[model samples]
Target: MTTTELINQIRKKKSFLCIGLDVDLNKIPQHLLKEEDPIFAFNKAIIDATHHLCVAYKPNTAFYEAYGLKGWKALEKTIKYLNEKYPEIFTIADAKRGDIGNTSTMYAQAFFEDLAFDSVTVAPYMGKDSVEPFLAFKNKHTILLALTSNAGAFDFQTKTVEGKELYKQVLDTSKTWENAENLMYVVGATKAEYLAEIRNIIPDSFLLVPGVGAQGGNLQDVCKYGMSENVGLLINSSRGIIYASSGEDFAAAAASKAEALQKEMAVELG
Candidate 1:
């Protein structure tokens, strides 16, 4: 989906929430285990129950990769279901993939062409050559890792390199790449205070922010600093919403959690 289309969905839904379909078989309702593809079953329920309250759904690739071929198949089914049923909803492959230039192109193809995800997360450690291949795709977004919410982010992202934080440098350097307009960024909600500085660099690029809810990042603080004129923030809540309950009412419980966030987002938009 294009940025315009994504923004339109946010306006129409009164939300910019991005539900993370980071399904864990162990945490899902035990009853779902009886199904042939429990992962997709769980994801389908969550998507069906909560799709209206959110604009995007992100399935972290690790969850699928863990189960091998079975898990991967479930992921395919989940994305196909979303594409066929809710074409308007933006989809993200939360696959933080980055490699050599040729390898990166194949990774881009797997997510963007074969799976048909609207966006995919990528690591920027390899520099422009690794990431430019993903950005080459028209209308498909390459969400580069910037200031992440993890505690380990301080190891490099915040460290000064050439008198500027590495995360800031990543934001600055990425803009010069071909088709850089299609780039979005991953900024942790925990680092809300830095968002003002981040915005000064990029000004208007969309940020796929995680670390809310279960990770204890404050929503109000993130919005205060990170929100752009177009509300360019996709606040993700994975465990808090999807794992709201471990019982048969899981889907409904997930919806309740999503509704609360959507309401909060609506207030922010207003």
Candidate 2:
């Protein structure tokens, strides 16, 4: 989806929430274990229940890859269901992939061409060559990692490289890349303090922010510094939403959690 389309979804839904489909078999309802494809079954139920409450769904690729081929198949089914059913909802393959130029091309094709994800997360450690290949795809977004929410982030991201922090360098240097307009970024909500400076570096780019719910990042703080005139943020909530209930009412419970967040988001958007 284009930036305008995404912003329109936010306006129409009165939400900027992106539900993370980070399904863990161990945590899912026990009854689903008997399904033909438990992972997809869980995802389908969650998506059906919560689709109207949020604007996007992101499936962290590692969650699917863990179960091997069946897991991958389950991911395919989940993504296909989303595409065929809710074409308007943005889909993100949170792969965090980056490699040599040729290898990156194949990864991009796998997610963008074959799977048809609207966006995929990429690690910017390998620099521009590792990222530009993903940007080559038309209408597909390459969300580069910036200041992450994890505790370990300060160890490297905040450290000075020459005169500036490494994360800031990544943001500034990325703008000089080809197809830079199609680039979005991953800025962890816990790192909201850095957002003002980050925004000054790229005022218009969208940011896919995780850590809002489960990681204890405050939504108000994120919006205060991170929000752009376009309302450029896709705030993700994973476990706190999907696992809201581990009982028979899991999907409904998940929907409730998502709806609550959407309400909060609506208030923020207003």
Candidate 3:
């Protein structure tokens, strides 16, 4: 989806919430394990329950990858269901993929061409050549990792190089690449204080922020500093919403959690 389309969805739904489908067989309702494709079954229920409450859905690729070919097929089915049923809803492949130029091109084709995700999370440590191939795809977004939510982020992201924080340099350098207009960023909500500074560097770029909800990152604080005029935020909540229950009513429970976040997001957008 284009930036304008995304912003419009935020306005229409009064939400910037992106529900993360980080599904694990061990965490889902035990009954689902009997299904032919437990992962897709769980995802379908979650999507059905919460689709109206949020503007986006992100399925982290690793979850499916760990399960091998069967898992990949489940993910494919889940994504296809979302696209066909709710085409307006933004979809992200939280793949965090980055590699050499040729391999990155294949990865880009896999997600953007074959699977048809609206965006994919990419690691930028390999520099412009590795990420630019993903950017080459029309209308598809490359969400480059900037400041992450993990504790390990402090070990490098915040480290100064020539007196500028490393993440700031990433933000600055990424803008210089071709098709940079298709770029969004992964900025952790836990680092909310740095958002104002990050905004100054790229005032209009959208940020796909995780680390809210279960991560204890305050929603209001993220919106206060991270929000742009277009409501440039896709705040993600994975475990807190999707795993709200381990019972047969799991989908309904997930809906309730997503609804709570969406309600708060509506107020923030206003």
Candidate 4:
């Protein structure tokens, strides 16, 4: 989806929430284990329950990859379901892919062309060449990793090179590449204080921020510094919402959690 379309959805729904469909078989309701595709079954229920409460849904690729071909088929079905049923809702392949230029192009085609995700998370450690390939697609977004929520982010992202943090440099350098306007950055909500500074670098670019809820990133702090005139934030809450229950009523419980966040977001947008 285009940036304007995304912003419109936020306005219409009174939310910019991105529900992370990080489905782990071990964590889902035990009854689903009997289903032919437990992963997709769980995802369908969650999506059906919370679709109206959020504008985006991100399925982290790792969860499906770990399960091999069957897992991949489940993911494919999940994306197809979203595309056919709720085409207006933005879909993100949280695949965090980056490689050599040629490989990166194939990766781009896999997610953008084959799977038809609206966006994909990409790691920037390989420089502009590795990432620009993903940015080449029209209307499809390449969400570059900036300051992440993990403890290991301090190892390089926060480290200063020539007196500037590495992530700031990534943001600055990425804008110089071709078709860079389609780029967004992943700024973890755990580092909410840096949002103001990050905004100064790319004032209008959307941010796919995770690390809220189960990760303990404060939603209020994230909005205080990250929100722009267009509500340029996609705050993600995975475990907190999807795993709200381990019983048969899990989907309803997930809806309740999503509603709570959407209600707060409505007030924040107001």
Candidate 5:
């Protein structure tokens, strides 16, 4: 989906919430295991229950890869279900993939063309050549990893490379790449204090923030510092929402969690 289309959905839904479908068999309701395809079954139920409460759904690729072929197939079915049923809700493949130029192109094709995700997260450690390939795709976004919320983030992202922080340099250098307009970024909600300076570098770009709820990132602080004129944020909550319950009412429980966030987001938007 294009930026305008995504923004419109945010406006229509009164939310910029991005639900993370990082399903783990151990964490999901055991009853779902009886289904022919438990992974997709779980995802479909969650989507049906909470579709109207959020504007995006992100399925981190690692979750599917862990279960091998069956997991992969479930991911395919999940994305297909979203595209066919609720095309307006933006989809993100949280793959964090980055490699040599040729490999990056193939990775891009896998997520953008084959799986048909609207966006995919990528690491910027390999620099422009590794990332520009993903950005080349029309209307498909390459969400670069910037200031992450992980404890180890300070090891590299915040370290000074020359005079500026490494993450800031990534943001500045990325703007010169081809099709930079299609770029979004991963800025962890836990690092909300750094957002003001990060925003100064790319004020108009969208940020896929993933440290809220279970990770202890405050919604109000993130919005206070990171929000752009277009409300450029996709706040993600994974274990907190999806694992709200491990019973038959899991989907309804997930919806309740999502609705609470959406209401907070509505207030933030106002």
Candidate 6:
């Protein structure tokens, strides 16, 4: 989806929430295990229950890839279901896939073409060639990793490079790429304080922020610093929403969690 379309959905839904479909079989309610494709069944229920409360759904590839071919089939089914049933909701393949040019092209095809995801997370370590192939696709987005919430992010992202933090350099350098306008970035909500600085570098680019909810990143702080006129943020909540309850009432429970967040977002938007 284009940035305009995404922002429209956020406004219409009164939310910029991105529900992370990071399904872990072990963690899902045991009742779903009885289904033909437990993973897809769980996802379908969650999506149906909560799609209206959020603007985007992100299925991290590792959750599916770990199950091998069966898992991949589940991923395909989930995306197909979303495309057919809720096409207006933005879809993200949180694959974090990046490689040499040729390899990256295949990765892009897998998510953007074959599976039909609107966007995918990409690592920038391989530089332009690795990310351009993903950006080359029309109407598809490449969300590059910037300042992540993980403790290990300090290992490199915050380090000074020519007197600028490496994350800032990533944001600065990426804007020069061909089709750079298609780029969105990943900024962890835990590092909400840095968003003011991040906005200074790219005031208009959308950011796919994770580390909210289960990761304990504060929503109020994220909005205070990260939001632009367009609500250029997709704050993600994975375990906190999807796993809100492990019993038969899971989907309803998930909806409740999502509704609470959406309500808060509505206040922020107001």
lDDT of 4: 0.95
CA lDDT of each candidate?
Answer: 0.96, 0.95, 0.95, 0.95, 0.96, 0.95
Q: Give the poorly placed runs of model 4, Cα more than 4 Å off.
A: none
Residue 37's lDDT within candidate 3 is 90
Q: What root-mean-square deviation over C-alphas does model 1 reach?
A: 0.5
- Candidate 4 residue lDDT tens string, 1-270: 899999999999999999999999999999999999999999999999999999999999999999999999999999999999999999999999999999999999999999999999999999988998998999999999999999999999999988799999999999999999999999999989999999999898899999998778998999999999888899999999999999999999999999999999999998
lDDT (10s digit) by residue, model 1, range 174-201: 9999999999999999888999999999
Off by over 4 Å in 1: none
RMSD vs true structure, all candidates? 0.5, 0.7, 0.7, 0.6, 0.6, 0.7
Estimate the lDDT of model 3: 0.95
TM-score of model 1 relative to the true fold?
0.99
Candidate 5 residues lying further than 4 Å off, grouped into runs, are none
* Model 3: per-residue Cα lDDT over 59-107, one tens digit each: 9999999999998999999999999999999999999999999999999
Give the per-residue lDDT digits (tens) of candidate 5, residues 44-120. Answer: 99999999999999999999999999999999999999999999989999999999999999999999999999999
Native-vs-model 6 lDDT? 0.95
4 or 6: which has the higher lDDT?
A: 4
Candidate 2 runs further than 4 Å off:
none
Clash number by candidate, in order:
0, 0, 0, 0, 0, 0
Enumerate residue pairs that collide in model 6.
Answer: none
| Candidate 5 structure lDDT | 0.96
**Cα deviation of 231 in candidate 2 (Å)?**
0.6
Candidate 1 lDDT (Cα, whole model)?
Answer: 0.96
Clashing pairs in 4: none
- Model 2: colliding residue pairs: none
